[model samples]
Target: GGDGAEEEQWSQPGNDLSLPAVNQTKGKCCFSLCPGIKIPKVMDFLPNILTINDSSLPQARTRCLENGIGYREKCFYFVEDEAEWNRSETFCRSLGAHLATIDTWQELRFLLRYGGSLHYWIGLRREGSAPWTWFNGSLFNNSFQIRGRGQCAFVNGDGISSDWCSLMKYSVCSHPQTRPTGSRRDPEVWNLT
Candidate 1:
């Protein structure tokens, strides 16, 4: 007989598999599939997902107070109306803002959770043959594949994906939330600056 004690992979009759158990401490957990078999901790295999620190950036200051939510140095607004990508950009500009540019999984998750099931046109686009870039000049780089519908980027539950720029969809906007402080009637006394 060859190697006699080689472990085999099999599933139990009614067990549902799940991710490796995690705890409050970012340390190892005794994850085991069988009576005597054990696998290494989740942190050892995937440090990026398991051990990212909270953002240190300050909260965003948005111009509008009605529908903006602050998160990690930016205020986000979800435009409920469905419109083409260009139209969405114009709408955001009208509000003194730009389409929301997602910078982290936390922001992405926040949008998805509140966006319902509608695909949202974000600020990512490709210029002719150039790579996808945000309207705010940030580069769009991620593990998600940027193929298939290869022109515009939209956000959904699965993740960001490229789509036809002409397709109408809801959009997210970001901008400074700060408003000018002054009395409306006293125009001459109010400092426009």
Candidate 2:
């Protein structure tokens, strides 16, 4: 008694509160059809399991020096330290990058999957009654909702959310490939698998 639409719906996140397809293995699904039980997505519970290792510290730093980290055309680096929004922005700039800007849900999911459990600042803000904007001057199209209330934005294991701009949190930075210097960093530094 399964329709194709239901299967398709299950494949997409938010359609049935399912974990994103990218995070699922071939035979493992994050959902179960129970009569009256609340099910959490894989993303909702993976934070505790995603801790960084002390050994990987050297490799992570090396990868940052070689290029950026993350899995995309552009390079991304996760600055695992606490700093205010402005200070975080300065730190990112110091590394020849800018605070992370998500242009699609894939990028967002990639960030969340490896972003650990802590809240991290991203490149978004809403001034007064104005709409949110990324650091690169593009309008935030609201591909995802901010989970809390405030003007600044951050991403956690669950997803993106709004918070106070002055709060100190970890941050991710992005170095674009199309910069004037014409340098392209390998995006395969971080193993998404």
Alpha carbon lDDT of each predicted model: 0.63, 0.64
Against the true structure, candidate 1 reaches a TM-score of: 0.55
Expressed as tens digits, the lDDT of each residue in 109-149 for candidate 1 is 88778776778888989877787789977777864555455
Please tell me which predicted candidate would have the highest TM-score against the true structure.
2
lDDT (Cα, tens digit) per residue for candidate 2, span 70-102: 466667888888998889999999987889988
Over 4 Å off in model 1, which ranges? Answer: 1-64, 143-147, 176-193
What does the lDDT come to for candidate 1?
A: 0.63
Error of 1 at 129 (Å): 4.4
Error of 1 at 55 (Å): 32
